[model samples]
Target: MEKNKKVVILNILLVGTIILNLFIFTSRMRFFPWFIEDAWGYLGVFLTAPILIGIYFMLRHFHKQQLVTSTNKVIPLFVAATSLIIVFMPTTDFLNIVAIVINAASVFLAANFLFNQNGGKNNYGFSRLKNQS
Candidate 1:
């Protein structure tokens, strides 16, 4: 597959996995009350493993393809950091909502960067900078 197309697909998969992680984390109590009541901490680890693995492999792929721009490199770090925070923090409704919003925003930023046509360039309001001599 073409590189751009592969990146797009990977981004899609990344976003989907993030959403799934959020859903499972937020609703684990309702969906698996027995498991949560018995092993809440382990549940966090179980839920987080896939996301961390996905981020690791995605970063590896980007690095292998020489697509590791500053912006793209930081995107996965932000995703992983926020995900870890969500997993390790004390679980409260407010905290969960806040974490979800932060995670979603980071994911949105990642998607924007991955899908940009200029290859993640930060123009800083100078749209014509690259074209200028």
Candidate 2:
């Protein structure tokens, strides 16, 4: 599959995991407003996180099509970010951290693909001199 398509699939799975975890965790929580109070707010916020994240990534993905690109540096950056996310996941009740890690991986792969295809684009922005003689 194409790198970008794979990245989108990863993102969908990641977000699905997050939303699923939120629902599951909240269902098990005995002290945090079962039917009313903050439960609704919490649910909204939880759902919002992945939705918003998805929107951002989707925007970035499409934007990349419009004179957008990537680099090898982005791969390392994603690796570092994913590592941090893994390190922090064990401490949290929600699995959003896992989502972040997956997102990082997708981005890294996309970046790697981008860099491999365009060494010059990696070193600098897209050429504005295509108009030059």
Candidate 3:
């Protein structure tokens, strides 16, 4: 129960952070308070979701085990959904760019897991699988 609670809190915090970052990014642009160099590096803020979602799916659903398609697919689907959520909107702020990049990474991962569950090649790095194969 404690672990579950922790996971829930962590997930909430992660999401909150992303949203807050986006809000801050937008606010910063209004007054031009941020340095040009700072804003320049913030283009890929949306990718955070995809990356985290992918890892979360792999851990929660895969058990780090390789399985044939038509087996359990719930986690992969969850991952895709999360990926979509993380990748909500694009922002020009550095922080937003980082978040977007993470989100996009998650999308790739979720898609990979989804495909793998459907008997497709595993592109989302299942590091353990390599040793087995």
Candidate 4:
């Protein structure tokens, strides 16, 4: 597949996994406290394994230094979603800690990629930060 397409797909997967993690975390906290236990937390880790793999692939693309103008548009959304999760999540357990780390890492990466020093008009560095008319 094309490189840009691959980046887009990876971004989608990353965002989807973050959303799922947030949903599971919130539901467990607010409504189904008993049903969501350590096992479920482990299950979330397992479910999020793809994100690790996706990051690996994304890193490969990043090494190539290809501009991901369209894919960059997803960064702010990812940052916002994960930030909300971090703000609302109760960090009282190991699983919560793991989730916090994941969200933080996602935010850091998106922010770094969005504002890389190499960013320029042509290279927008994979992020699409432009004003629409």
Q: Which stretches in model 3 have alpha-carbon errors above 4 Å?
A: 23-28, 35-51, 54-133
For model 1, where is the 10-residue window of minimal lDDT? 33-42
Instruction: State in Å the error of residue 22, model 1.
Output: 3.0
Cα lDDT computed for each candidate against the true fold: 0.61, 0.45, 0.42, 0.52
State every prediction's TM-score relative to the real structure.
0.59, 0.27, 0.30, 0.46
Any idea what lDDT model 1 has?
0.61
Evaluated at residue 60, the lDDT of candidate 2 is: 63
lDDT for model 2, on a 0 to 1 scale? 0.45
How does candidate 1 fare on TM-score?
0.59
Quality of model 3 by C-alpha lDDT = 0.42
Provide the lDDT at 17 for model 4.
Answer: 62
Could you give me the TM-score of model 4 versus the true structure?
0.46
> What is candidate 2's TM-score against the reference?
0.27
Write model 2 residue lDDT over 84-115, tens digit each, in one string.
Answer: 44434453435544544454555555544444
Residue 26, model 3: Cα distance from true site in angstroms = 1.6
lDDT of 2 at 33: 61
Looking at model 4, residue 87 earns an lDDT score of: 40
